[model samples]
Target: MKYLALWFFIIGVVLIVFIQFITSQNVKRLTEGNKRLLAEVAIQNRLRLLQNDVLTVESDIRGVVITDDRTHLSNVNDKIESIRREVSALRTDLRGEHAETYITELDTQVGRKIVFSQAILNAYDSKGKEAGEAVINTGRGKVLRDSIVQAVHQLDSIRQYRLNGIISNIENNGARARFMGVGLAIIACLACVLAFLYVVNKGRQQERMIQMLNESEKRIKEGAFIKEQFLANMSHEIRTPMNAILGFTNLLRRSSLTQQQQQYVDYIYSSSQNLLTLINDILDLSKIEAGMMHIEQTPFSLNGLVSSVQVMFADKAQQKGLQLTINVDPSTHDTLSGDPVRLTQVLINLLSNAIKFTERGFVHFEVRCLSQTDDEVVLQFRIKDSGVGIAPEKRKAIFERFQQAEAETTRKFGGTGLGLAIVKQLVDLQGGTIHVESEVGKGSEFIVRLPFRPIQNHTEAFAAPAEAVLNPVRGMRILVAEDNQMNQQLIRHLMRQWQMDHVMVSTGREAVEALRREPFTAVLMDIQMPEMDGYDATQAIRGELRSDVPIIAMTAHAMTGEKERCLSFGMNDYISKPLKEAELYAILQAYFRTADAQPAPAVVNLQYLRELSLGDTEFENAIVRQFIVQVPEELGLLQEAVQAGNKGQIKSIAHGMKSSVAYLGLTERLSPFLHRMEVEAVSGTDENHFQEDYEEVRRVCEQAVIEARALLSTSA
Candidate 1:
C-alpha cells in the first residue's frame, strides 16, 4: 500500500511538471511569433513611406516641368534620400527564399528613380523648364515611378505572406499547448482522487482497530473486577474456617499428648501457619497494589519487636541443625515510635525466608543503629543467611510479586514470592529502604534501614505481675455471639478456663435477644452470622436498645481496616478469630483492669553451657551458680550506673556482661537491654527506653535465677 501511494504521488508530480512544460512552450512560441510579426510590420511601414516618397519625387519633377519652379526642386533631393533609406530597411528586415531578390530589385528601382529625379532637377537647372519638361514628357520618370511602385508592392506581398506564416505557427503551438496542458491536468486530478481514496480507506481501517481496542480494554477491566471480587470472597471464606482450625490447633498444642502425636500436631500447626502467612502476604500485596495499605506510628519497644521475630524462626533453625543468631547494636534505641506491626512483618518475612532456604548452614540477624537524634533514630536491620544464594542475573526479579530467583526456586523452595514484595512495600510506605546482596550458590544478605521516632519518658499503661494466675474478669458477665460451632467450642474452653461468667449464642439475633433480656459487662460479637449479621445486631443494640455496653468485634475478615470498620459501627473494640488467648484476656483486662495473672517466665536455654561442658556436670553446675550470682549483682551495678547517668560505668558493665549472658544462652535476651542502656548513657538521647530495657532485664534475670535454682536442685 505504501508503495502504491508513493507511485501515485510520483505520478501526480510528473503530471504537474508536464503541464507547466506545456504552458512554457506555448509562451516561448508566442514570444517568437510576436517578434517576427513586429519586424514584418516595421518593413511594411518603411515600404509605405518609400512608396509615398517616390510619389512626392515624381510630383516635384512634374511640378518643375509644368510650373518651371526651381523652389519645388529644392527639397526633391531630400525625398530621394528618404526613398534610399526605406529600401535599406526592407533589405535588412526581409528573410525568406525570395526575400533578398525582392529587396535587391526594389533597392535598384528606387535608386534609379532617385537618380532620374536628380537628373530632371539638373535638366531644369541647366536647360531650363522646356528641356526638363520635354525630358519628363518622354514618360521615362513615370516608368521609373511605376517600376518603384511595383517593386514596393512585391515586397509588401512577401512581408504579408511571412506574417501569415508566423501567425499560423503561433496558433498551432497554442493549440498543442492547450491540448497537452488540459490532458495532463485531468490526469493530475485523477491522481489526487486516488490519493484521497487511499487515505480514506486507511482511516477506516484505523477506526476499526481503535474500536476493537476499546472493546478489548473494556473486557480486560471487567476481568480485573471479577478477579478482585474473587480474592475478597476467597479471603473471607478461607479465614472463617481457618480461624477455627488455628484456634483448635492452639488449644491442641497446649494439651498433653504422646511424642509422635506432638510431632504430628507440630506439623499441622506449622503447615497451618505457613498457609496463613501466604494468605496474609497475598492480601498485603493486594492492599499495597490498590493503595489501601497505610503505616501507623505507634510507640513500641524495638528490642521486644525484633526479639519476637528472632524467636519465630529459632525452632526451624534448630530443627535443621543450623546456628541461628540475632544481635542488636548497643547504641540502638529500644523504644521507638513507629509501625510495630509492619516492622514485625518485614523482619519475619525476611528471616523466615532465610531459614527456609538455609538447609545446612547458619542464619544470622543483626540490628544496628545507623543514626540518631534527640527525638528520632534510624536503625539498620541486616538479615544474612548462608543458604542457596540468588543468581546475579535474577536478583531484581525476586522482589516482584509472584516472582523469585528463577522458576526452579519456586519449584524447589515453595513460596508465592510475595514476601519480598510486601517487605519492599512496607519499608517504602514507612519512609525506609531495603536492598539485597547475593552470590549464586554462596549466600544472601538483605539490608533494610528504617526510621523511627524515639519514645521518651516511657510509662507502662498495664503491667502483668509475675506471681500467680488470677482471672481479670472472674464472674464478670460476658456474652458471646458466634456462628461456628468449633469456634464457639474453642471460646467455651477458654471462658471455662478463665472462670468467667459467660453465655454463648450461635447467632447475632439470639445474642441481641439475650442482651435485651439482661445486662452484660461485654459482648463478643462475631461479624458474620446466619440470621442477622454483627453489624445489624450492633445497630439494634445501640440504636434500638440504647445501651452502652462494650462490644468487642470478633471476626475472620482480617483486612487492613477491619478494626476501624467494626469501631465505626458502634463497636467498642475489635479482635479477630482464631483469636489469641492472651489478646482476648488483655482486652478484657483493659476494660476491667483486675488481672493478677502471672507473666510466663522466659525459659532459660542452657544449650551453650551444655556445649561448653562436654558432659561435665560439675562444670555445668559451677557456671549455672556463677551465672545466678553474677547476673543479679552486675544488673544492680548497671542499674546504679544508669541511675547516676554515668556513661563510662554503664558501658563498662554492659560490655563485661556479654560472655556471662552468652554462657547461659541469653545474649538475645540481655544484649538489647544492655545495648540500649549503654547507648542512652553515652549518646544522651533518651533515658526512658534505657529504664524500660533495664526493668525488663531485671525481671527476666530474676526469673532466670528461680528457674536455674530449680534446675540445679533437680540435677542434684
Candidate 2:
C-alpha cells in the first residue's frame, strides 16, 4: 500500500513539471505573435503617411503651375524617397511570401508614383510648361491615391486574421490548463484516501495483536495460580500419610516382636521411605515448574558417586540374578564441584529403573570424562539395562509427567511415571542434557552429560557407606500433651523403649496442670485438643508460670505454612503427626542438653513431693525431708500462697508441681486436681467443675505417695 502511494506521488510530480513546461512554451509563442502584429500595424501607418506625402506633392505641383516654386518640389521629392525606404524595411521585417508580395506590389506602385512626381519636378526644372501639361492629362495622382487605399485595406485584413487565430488558441490553451488542474486535484484526493486507508488498517492490526497478547497473559497467570494451589494441596496430602507410616514404624521397632512382626515393620519403614522419595520428586517438579529450583555447587567425588549408584542397585540386581557392572574412566578426577543431591537423584532414578526392569541379563553404568579445562570439566554418565525397552513412538512422551509407555508397561512395572520427568527437569535445571538410545526387546541406555567446576575449599569428604540412623533419646523426661488415647499410648511406649520417662495427659488443661505440679524436661504438645490447644497451653505456661520449657508441637495438618505457624505460637520446635520418632528424639535431645547444662537447679518437683504424703507416714516424711533439703524456701512460699487463697499464686505453685510430678512419673497423681484448681482460681468458675477434678487428682496422688513411700523404705 505504501509503495503504491509513493508511485502515485512520483507520477503526480512528473505530470506537474510537464504541465508547467507546456504552459511556459504556449505563453512564449503568444507573446511573439503579439509583437509581430504590432510591428505590422506600425508599417501600415507608415505607408498611409507616404501616400499623404505623394498627394501633397501633387497638389503643390498643380498649384505651382500658375506660380512656378521649384524649392517646394525638391522638398516633396526627398519626402517621397524617405517613405519608399520605410515601405521596403516593413516588407523585409514581415517575412511571409504573401505579405511580402503585397508589400512589394505596393512599394512598386509607390515607386511609380514617386517617379511620376519626380518626373514632373524634372520637367518643371527642364521644360516646365510642356512637362506639366503632359502629366496633368495622364491623372497619375488619383490612381496612386486609390492604390494606396487598397494596400492599406489588405494589411488591415491580414492583421484581423492573425488576431482571431491568437484569440482561438488562447481559449484552447485555457481549457487544457483547466482540465490538467482538475486531473491533478483528483489524483491528490485519491492519494489522501489511500494514505488514510493504510493508516487505519495498520492501527487495527496493531490493536488486534495487543488484544491477543493480553488474553494470552491473562491465561498464563490463571494457569500459574492453579498450579501453585495444586502443589500446595498435594504436598500436604502426601506428607500426611507418610508421617503416619514412618511414625508407626518407629513405634513398632521398639516393641519385643517376632521375626514376622519385624519383617512387617521393615516393610512399613521401606514403603514409607519410598513414599517420601516420591513426594520429594513431586516437590522438585513443582519447583522446576515455578522456576524456583536452583543448583548448589559443592565439591563431590564423581568416582564415588558412580560407585555408590552401582552399590545401590547391586542388591536388587543380585536378587533378580542379574549382573551389575560399573565402569569409570581413570582420567576423570575423583573430586569435582556440583550439586550432588540433584545429580545423585538423577543417577539413582536411572539405575533403580534399570535394575527394576532388567530381569535376567545385566545392568551397567559408565562414567567418562569427556573433556576438561581449568575451570570446567564435562562428564558423561550412562546407565544401560537389558530390559523391555521403550518403543520408538513412546520414547518422547516418557519424559512428560505422569506418562508411561503404555498401560501394560505401567501395570507390569508399577511406578508413578514421574521419575524420568523429574530426572529430565533436574538435568535441565543443572544446565545439562539427557538422552536415551534403545531398541524394543534388546536393551536401553540412558546418557546424561553435565559440567562441573572445582571448589576451592572443601570441608567434608563424601561417604557412601554411612547409613542414616535415628539418634537415641535416653533418660529424657517428656511431657506428652495429647488428647488422643491411641496416639498417647504409642508415644508412651516409644519413649519407654528409648529409656526416656514421660508424663501422658489428655488435654491442654492437664498439660498446664502437669507443668505446674512438676518440672518437665520438654513438652510434646499436640495442636488440636478439647478446651485448649497446644498453642494456648504454651502461651499460658510461658506467660503465667514464666516457664521457658521447650515445647515440640505435633499436628496432623501438614499445610505449607503450618510448621512456621506452630513455631510462631511459642513452640520451641515442631513435628508433624503421625510423628517420626527421629524428629521427636532429636528435638528432645537438643533442648534437654542445653537445659541440663544450666548452673542453677531451675525448678522443683512440687507435685511429686506432694504425692509421697499418702504412703507410710515415716517414709513419706523422709521423702518430704529430701524435698525440703533441696528447696526449702520455695516450699514455704507455696504454703503461704495456698493458705492465702491467692489463685494466681496457687496456679503458679501448681505449674511448678506439674513439672516436678512429670519428672517423678507421678503426673497422674496430682495433675488433674491441680489443673481444676488452677482454672477455678483464674476464671472464678463454679465449684462443681473444680470439686470433681480435685477428687480424681487427690485419689491418684494418694496412691502415688503410698508407692513412693514403700520404694523409699525398701531402699533404706
Which candidate wins on TM-score? 1
Local lDDT at 344 for model 1: 85
Which sections of candidate 2 miss by over 4 Å?
1-223, 250-256, 267-308, 333-338, 453-716
Q: Write the per-residue lDDT of candidate 2 for residues 1-716, one digit (tens) a residue.
A: 66876676666666667767766776776666566656655665665676676677677777665467555666765677677777777677666645776677677777777787767766767887767767766877678767866776676567667656766676676677667666765676576667667768878988998999999988987887677667755665555556656767776776789999999898889878877877777777877786657787644556545544554555577679988888889877655767776898998999888887887799888899888877988999999999988889988998999998777877787788899999998898889999999888888899999999843322222222211122223457888988766676678767876788889998899999999999888898987778998889999999988998878887765444566787787887677765655445545654553333433211223333334333445533444333222122223334455555555555555544553344234444456677766677788654425445544544444333333332332443
Query: Any residue pairs clashing in model 1, and if so which?
Result: none
Estimate, for each residue in 1-716, the C-alpha lDDT of model 1 and write its tens digit.
86797688789988998889879878988998999889878878888888888898898778867886668666887777776776776676564557787778778888887788778777878888887877778888788888878888887898899889988998898888889888889899898788878889989998999999999988877876565666656777788778878888878887999999999988998799889888888878877875668887554556545544554465578789999987889777665767777898899889989988888888889999999998779899999989999988888888888888878777788888899989998999999999999987788999999989874422212222222222233557789998888888888888888888789998989988999899888899988889999999999999989998889898877676777788889997787655776557656643442345444554477665555456778767766665655566667666766676656556556665654565556666777887877666677665347568778877666656656654554564
Candidate 1 off by > 4 Å: 21-25, 56-79, 95-98, 128-135, 251-265, 281-351, 360-384, 390-441, 444-482, 487-716
The per-model lDDT (C-alpha) reads 0.77, 0.67
Lowest-sum lDDT 10-residue window in model 1: 458-467
RMSD of 1: 14.6
Tell me how far the alpha carbon of residue 475 in candidate 1 is from the true structure, in angstroms, after superposition.
12
